[model samples]
Target: MRRAASMGMTTPTTPVAIDPADLAGVFDRYARDLLRYCTRRVGEQVAEDVVAETFLVAYERRDRYDASRGEVLPWLYGIATNLLRRHRRTEIRALRALAHADGGARAAEGPAQRATDRVDAERAVGRLSAVLAKLPRRQRDVLMLFAVAELEYAEIAEALQIPLGSVQSALHRARAKVRAALAEGDAR
Candidate 1:
């Protein structure tokens, strides 16, 4: 007697074709990062809405995507950054929120930790936030892309439409200000 063959067995899996649905999945995967970036650049309250809008805009423009350019993260970042720039007031509000929240209950630390440590960390964050606010838009963008988004310099240059050298310079300047602020706090 011959053994029964499997009815649904396949030789090998074929590469699935990419469609709008696949593109949507990509958007979903990157949405959290985009939202975080927007929240940092703008405010948490507006971040969800802004990130939704950004994905919508990206979806509309997806056909223009070039496969030769590699992954879509940099492209998404560029789009989000542009949207962030258009809403400067929202960005200011976000920074203000950071300042206000810095002094309040800590998120990661326990409630019973040393008060002095909390105060020192809060003060440092506040001073850094103030200095960050005073930076030029380009510098701030570079700093955020580097420190927060954790993108490489080339990726940041692509996202911000700046030269690699400019990315380096902006980061250097932002770092200098942050260091100076921390040092000043130390002296005091």
Candidate 2:
């Protein structure tokens, strides 16, 4: 045992010299952020799978990762975004399901305030979904990453592989469209 220990035969080889503990810490810290981003991009139901695939891909490609470039969050965001793009059909399906659920009229209950509040919340989310569907993919992505994922413009640009200016422009256009839709609804 002493000979094996001295020879380092019992030690497992990792891709890099970085300690596995450090890697685990990094994952723990960022996992929730990545999961939230995935949920917003796709839906909560598929978010777990997207996050698992993202981390798996990141691990496999760890050798090529450049730590000196910047923080790992943006790189991970880029990976998650790419995965989300592949599942656009699923996202559309989720949106449609939400819209259908929202299309039904809610039951009025005079006695229960909580039930009324829940119905109102669902109605608002459904309206938002309807508006979100009308946005171009890039614009919708930028809007969600900014508002839901709470990513900075530079991070959004990196994830979407767009210019920083494009991120700003896309968000501006997306917000304007959403506002116009809300205005039209109010007018009605």
lDDT of 2: 0.73
- Candidate 2 — which residues are off by over 4 angstroms? 1-22, 107-117
Per-model clash counts, in order, read: 0, 0
**Across residues 1-188, which tens digit of lDDT does each residue of candidate 2 receive?**
01212322223343232233345555676779989878876778799999888888877776555544455677778888888989988887777667666522643533344466677677767767778877899998899888977888997898778999999999999999999987776577
Provide the lowest-lDDT 10-residue window in model 2: 1-10
Which regions of candidate 1 fall more than 4 Å away from where they truly are? 1-19, 96-114
What is the clash count of model 1? 0
- For each candidate, what is the lDDT? 0.72, 0.73
Give the C-alpha miss distance for residue 112 in model 2, angstroms. 4.6
lDDT of 1 by residue, 11-127 (tens): 234322224555666665688898888887776777787888887877787666553444567777888888888887777656666666655456346565657767677866776
Displacement of the residue 138 alpha carbon in candidate 1, Å: 0.6
